[model samples]
Target: MTAVLFFLFAAAALAGALGVVLSRNPVHSALWLVLTLLSVAVFFLLQSAQLVAAVQVIVYAGAIVVLFLFVIMLLGVDREETLSDPIKLQRPAAIVLGVLMLGEVLVLAGHEWATGAQTAHGVPIHGLMDTGTDPGNNIERVARVLFTDFLWPFQLTAALLVVAVIGAIVLARRSGERPEDPGPGIPAAERARPGSGSGERPEADAETSEGTS
Candidate 1:
């Protein structure tokens, strides 16, 4: 039954991941991302890692996806842009990198993969699987290994996130600046104010005799 559930969620995760890439609508892509994240949390649950699963659901699915949706909506979902690729060799580079990543997955699949031991950078819920005495054993053990063993990498990730946030704020400050032309749909009075000389807008009344009269 465990294997059955695992395969089911694994399929769902893969489908959701594909949907995220293939879906044209940003909102639909974000919903697909939520499914992928939830499936990953289920993977942790299958390993009896409740804390890690909760964090995955809460942090990635809840917070990160919400932020993504917020940004998508704020940028105006109705707006469309040209689908042309702006960067050179982008498609080829993506294909190459994707193939390399697939090769890595196949390599790992051939190896004997197990939990309850330290992963490449992060440790699993070994404490939970080993001892039933302590309720917070999983939390304590994982936190200790993460802080001591993978502290530098964690710090680097945090610094990168901080830098991204700062860059977003700087860009947001420029959103208010727009073109001076209102682009149609304005009252005649607002467009042409009284007591203003024709020199203020030579283009507006170029053929009229108001200024010449």
Candidate 2:
């Protein structure tokens, strides 16, 4: 059962990662990234690292990805013109890096499997087997560690979130007010003036008929 779950999660993570790179639309790519993050959390859960899994879900999958989506939406990217053969070299490079990463992961997994490894508590580490006293207590232990020893990092993360929010707002805002133009009609004060050149001109007097006679 553990083997089956590990394979399933690994496949899901790979597929989601591929989708993130290959998807044309940025929104779809972001969604794919979310999926990839979720699969990673599942992998952590399978390894009995419940704390790491929770952090993966809360920080990466929840906060970071949501911020990415927010920025994407705020930018209002046009999906039609997004992936139209732009950045030709980037795609191949990304594929190569992804493949190399997958190879590294496989090698690491194999090495861990070969060794008779044990958790910090000296219990044998099986893929998905739970060897702890109470599975429910794992969350409590994680909370204690995070609040005690790791409190500084947690506070720093919160500060980073605040900065991100401010940066996003600044980036999205338009600078300065738009220029205004006077309307076609003359100004009220000018129209009120008697000889302001705005009102109708006086008619020209008729030619002096007496002088001609």
Candidate 3:
């Protein structure tokens, strides 16, 4: 039944989200994120919104998750960090915000259910729902509403994303300017010239002794 399928997908999404938070390795976290995104796409499918589901799967699960994995792998950030919290009151603040968001969602869901409309908690909040059409409408209607009704905000979002991308690039370049910290496998002396092999310093010492003798 649809109800059973909905619960199953919802459970999967919740589990995946928890896995993303609890997994120590960044790569594992990214995989869990893919699971969560895929489950959300399934939610769209259950609502008969095939286009949204396909976009969710392709853009989020496929491209975005792969990009996350690539960054974790390439940047050598797969290792776990210390468990100590860096910011003061961060955990308590996050818990408060999460509780507030959950309360808001519950209230909206209850309101929509009481209204008995297929609005899905006022999904297209900018305008009224098109009760005349079935749930299987394609993305054309969504696109039209986005461009016509929300064009300025959409353009602002695009500019913000562009600024974020530039900021990330600048940060990455700045980080690269600093010398890399020594890893467990690297000796303090060799960290400066990791390419010079493990015997490099000893060979230099031998050469200096021979020259003195």
- Best-performing candidate as measured by lDDT: 1
Model 3: per-residue lDDT, tens digit, 144-196? 77899999999999999877655544333212235644324334554454434
TM-score of model 1 vs. true structure: 0.58
lDDT comparing candidate 3 with the true structure: 0.69
lDDT of 1 by residue, 25-140 (tens): 88989999999999999988777677899999999998999989887977678354357789988988999999999998877755655332334435333422554455556788
State how far residue 140 of model 2 sits from its true place (Å): 3.0
**Candidate maximizing TM-score:** 3
Tell me the tens digit of each residue's lDDT in model 2 across 1-213. 777877898898999998987788888888989888999998888878887888999999888889788778766883644555577788789889989999998777657465545344454457654737754556776777789999999999999987765554443332223333323343546434423341132111011111211
Candidate 2 regions exceeding 4 Å error are 81-136, 177-213
lDDT of each: 0.70, 0.67, 0.69
TM values, all candidates: 0.58, 0.57, 0.59
Instruction: For model 3, give the 10-residue run with minimal summed lDDT.
Output: 123-132
TM-score of 2: 0.57
TM-score of 3: 0.59
Q: Candidate 2, 36: how far from true, in Å?
A: 1.4
The CA lDDT at 41 in model 1 is 93
Rank by TM-score, highest first: 3, 1, 2
